[model samples]
Target chain A: MDWISLILIPAIKSLILVIVLLTGFAYATWFERKLIGRFQQRIGPNRAWTFGLGHPIADALKMIFKEEIVPSYVDKILFVMAPGLAIVPALLIFAVVPVGPNITLFGREIPLVVADVNIGLLWVLAVAGVGVYGIILGGWASNNKYSLLGALRTSAQMLSYELPMGVLLIAILLTTALGTADGAGTLSLVQIVNMELPWYIRIWILLAFPLYFITMLAETSRKPFDFPETENELVAGFQTEYGSIKFALFYMTEYLHILGASGVAVSVFFGGWRGPFVEQAPILGVFYFAAKLIAMVFLFIWVSASVPRPRYDQLLRFCWTFLFPVSLVYLAITAAIVILL
Target chain B: MAVSDGIKGAVEIAKSMAVTLRALLAGPLTVQYPEQPIAIYPRFRARHELRRYGNGLERCIGCMLCEAACPTGAIHVEAAENDPEHPVSPGERYAKVWEVNLMRCIFCGDCETACPVEAVVLGHEYELAGYSRDDLLWTKERLLEPTRPNVIIRTE
Candidate 1:
């Protein structure tokens, strides 16, 4: 294949991914508001024309039109660049996530994934790691007491959850390796999904799935694990000094990160773009991925609405004392079983 | 707080999930709002509207009962001796200055209950929004109805 086939096609695919993802991020806000509003026995934002569907567009417009205020005494450079930093890594992680299986378009066969890197799972974790830096930077740059506190909380919370998350992934990888008879387990995400029954679905891997989910929820800074930008204490967290489009950027980054986390979960545990009739009609893979992603998002929002934020100590304690031990033990057991069998 | 507490917590989470699932299937309890208008109770205390007597005279007797009843101290009434030539209120002393800072008012219906002559009634008009706090202060002029405009007032 020439450079056009290798480079140009992927560039086009990445462009499409970026456009779809940005649009998805916008509507994700509206969808979450609507669902969560109903959960609380109240109607959500329905004033934005056409069943409140235009709310995201309206919000985007408002953010753009609003004044971009930079307080007099703050770290000017980092404050300005933080949003971009948060957004970049979030977008970068999607490079390996395939929306659909390979298909022939205009007589040219192309893979659905943007990069299809062999170490896609590692790439996801690496890129995700960078996302926190944005929050930490934004929080520190703001020079506000609350913002600084929120930033530190985010750092601690994310770091704490990540350990258990890694353990769970390790267990999952072990299961994948053991599941097949022919080959050693693959690290490529597409291959993981392509497996008929992912290790997470098996009875042995069942325990790992829920723990992984909790870690993901915590990592995303959702309601249950939310301490970073909690409304009552932190006063909008790291983005306290942020306003206008910059504030909107942080929000967008958070949502995008949520999507990334959900998609990763879908790919890693639940079958990603792998469902009945996916191979026969490859386009259906996109729908499968989307449906799973939506369900994951719904679960997050539902949990967010139902669960009240725990005390700060309680949250950290839950992770360290409970999740960490359970996942580590599970990983140890699974690894031993895989090695033995 | 104990070992049982953790199990109880687990059960509570499941119970919460069941409740949410039930709520989801039951559909959103939210009204479609403007398209399907909200049905409020007839006795619902909302915006305050001043009333007038059959003789087309203001019903306020300038008694500071409503002012005392307001929990937020929103009402300020300065009563004056009514002009015999043109008596606005039925009593000798009428409220020359009637102001209600809605920002402070809690719409507790206490003022409506406290009014002796029923001059001030909490009516169904709760679209109170403005850029400034000054706009929220409902004056006597704004509160009083303008004789229903072109409608003929049949004097009993």
Candidate 2:
């Protein structure tokens, strides 16, 4: 194949992924509102065009038209770049996600993913890790003491949780290795997802599901783990100095990150695009993927409304003392089971 | 041991099923707001409507007090001098340009209470559903007194 064709394939796939991810992020906000509204016994944004589908558009328009204020003491360049930095990694992680099976489009067999490198899982982790830089940089560059304190708290929280997140992946890796024919392993998400196993092993893996899920929630800085931008302590946190479109970018990125995290969780645990009855149909894979993602997104919103934020000490203690040890034990148990069996 | 395990499992299953059974017997919780109307609270602040006096004269004196009280700046009002030829109310001035941006309004009831003459009041018709931003922006005419054949008693 020519280099041009190779480059064009990924470029086109990435463009489609961007459109789908952005649209999904927009609707995720709507989904959160509607679901949380019902939970709280109120009707949400139902008046903004066809069951409130246009609420996001209305919000975007308002943000764009609103005045952009730049504080005098802030580092102007970093302040401007922070939101883009936050959003870019969020958009990029979706490129590795497989939405469906290979399909022949225009007489060419095209994979459902934008990029399917061997180290796809690692690529996701690395991209997500870099997203924290946006928060840290935005907070520091603002020259506000509260912003700096919030950034410090966020950095520590993310760092503490990331260890357990990585350790939990080791358990997943062990399960994948045992399911394979040879003792060797393939860490590609597609290959791992395709591995079949008995109920005993499947149940064991499912037990660790909550660990990864909670860590993902913390990684995204969502409620219950949302100390970074706690409105009570920090006034809008890192984005305090940002306004208008800049602030909109940060808001959009938060939604996108939640979507990306949910996508990864579904792919790893729930079997990406794999349904009980629809595995044979390639097109149904997309439906299965969407359903799983929506369920995970709903869980995020439900938990946000139902749970209260943990104190800073509690958050750190839970991650380090509870999650870290449990994940480490899970890895050891899985490895022992694999070796002995 | 087997009997105990069976009894324990049955008890757990029944406990979960009891919740579903109660929900099924309790009837539907949904009110179907559009199809079947529900009673609104007496103090509920819904859509704004200009109140009329006993003699059918408008209560608003074009003070713009509601506009000033709005936290979201949703209300817009312009006062024009009332003339003997085309007088809108008994007051010296009347609101020529009155608009409420429903999109921005938080519906905090501050605007209704700010009215000095008790002209602006939130009604019980809470269904302020709209299809677009323009639809949400209630103009002076849409917000004026109800012009129907039958006259009803106004509840405070």
Candidate 3:
């Protein structure tokens, strides 16, 4: 590949991806507030602009002017770097997620994804797994007991949930490999999105979908599973000491992760950008991708508003005793079916 | 039994989600206070005002009953004989100095009930925020005025 195609294209795609995700992050806050407000029969935020469209801009201005207070007792270097560390992995997960198929522009083919690595699914998981360190470091460096406790819960939660998540994903990969005509499956997210498996093969994913959904909610630290930031118990958790733009960065990382997780789920399960007339008009694929992403995000917000947060012990126990064994049994059943077929 | 319990738990969660969905469809009951003014109850007591007769004469007879009746001692009244040439009120005596310290007034309407001629009545203006102590101290001139400031006055 030429320098322009290899380096410049990827750089440009990265720039676009960053801008879109940040903007999406801003609007996601407004969206959640409005939707959740409706769930409780309250008008959310309609003061900034019509239906609070400019609320994110107003929020950004407020955060920008706030006093950036670093506590006197904190480990200064780690405290400052933790928010940055938390945000980078959240943004990196989307680098391999293909938004749409390749489009020819000026007689040159341009893929919609930033970096289409062969080990895309693994890269998504690896980058997502790295995000917990940011919380752990933030909690530890604060030198407060509550922060330490929150950090500990976060690490425990991530460890317990990631096991089932990984096992289920491996099962998916095995199914794709075995179900294919060539019997050769690729780990690339773009390829997985493009694959059209038979109905019998798709049945395995049906069994895995609800389990994967639960894992996704846990991975994002969203409500019903948001043990780390349990305000009633931890008083803002790991971010208790953070203030101003540093705090804003931590907040931004959360929304970005939500968008990233939804993007990965869309590409992996819902066929990325596949829609009616998508092959005929490739640009329409981006719209389809956006529509699916918004729907997925709506599901997250709905779950948050409807479900109550479980106790920390109950959450961990549910994972270890119930989810773990159930997934293991499902994995065994899948393996047996794959071999028998 | 455990498997059935898990299924039941999932069903309950789904039912709760359905309730929230129903709430989402039902539009918000919020009354936009600034742009859309809300109706005040007829019996609601707020800022104190001194009433007047249709002939443009003050109803207060400067009896000092309200001052004595005020539980918080928020009301201050001074009596002076009304000038025969230009009577401020229909009565022989009128209030020379009248002040109501709103910071102390609990809006219990004790002063309103104590008035002999129905002079001191609490108005419907509820927005009583003031920047300073003096601003909150409603004087005779301020109380006598037909319109009240610092409140969004609406007919409804």
What is the number of backbone collisions in each predicted candidate, taken in the order shown? 0, 0, 0
Candidate 3 predicts chain B with a TM-score of: 0.90
Instruction: Give one digit per residue, the lDDT tens place, for model 2 in A49-94.
Output: 9879999888888999999987999998988788889899999887
Off by over 4 Å in 2: A3-5, A276-280, B1-156
Pairs that collide in candidate 2 are: none
True contacts kept of 3: 0.76
Considering only N, C-alpha and C atoms within 3 Å, which residue pairs clash in candidate 1?
none
lDDT of 1 by residue, B15-115 (tens): 88778767766767777755665666656667788898999899998999999999999999989999999998889999888899999889998999999
Which of candidates 1 and 3 reaches a greater DockQ? 3
The candidate that achieves the highest TM-score relative to the unseen native structure? 3
Instruction: Looking at model 2, give its docking quality level.
Output: incorrect
Question: Candidate 1, residues A198-224: lDDT per residue as tens digits?
Answer: 433476766567778888988989888
Worst ten in a row by lDDT for model 3 chain A? A172-181
Task: State how far residue A138 of model 3 sits from its true place (Å).
Answer: 2.5
Shares of reference contacts reproduced by the candidates, in order, are 0.33, 0.00, 0.76
Residues B73-120, candidate 3: write the lDDT tens digits: 999999999999999999999999999999999999989998989999
Candidate that scores best on lDDT: 3
**CAPRI verdict on model 3?**
medium
Q: How accurate is candidate 1 locally (lDDT)?
A: 0.85
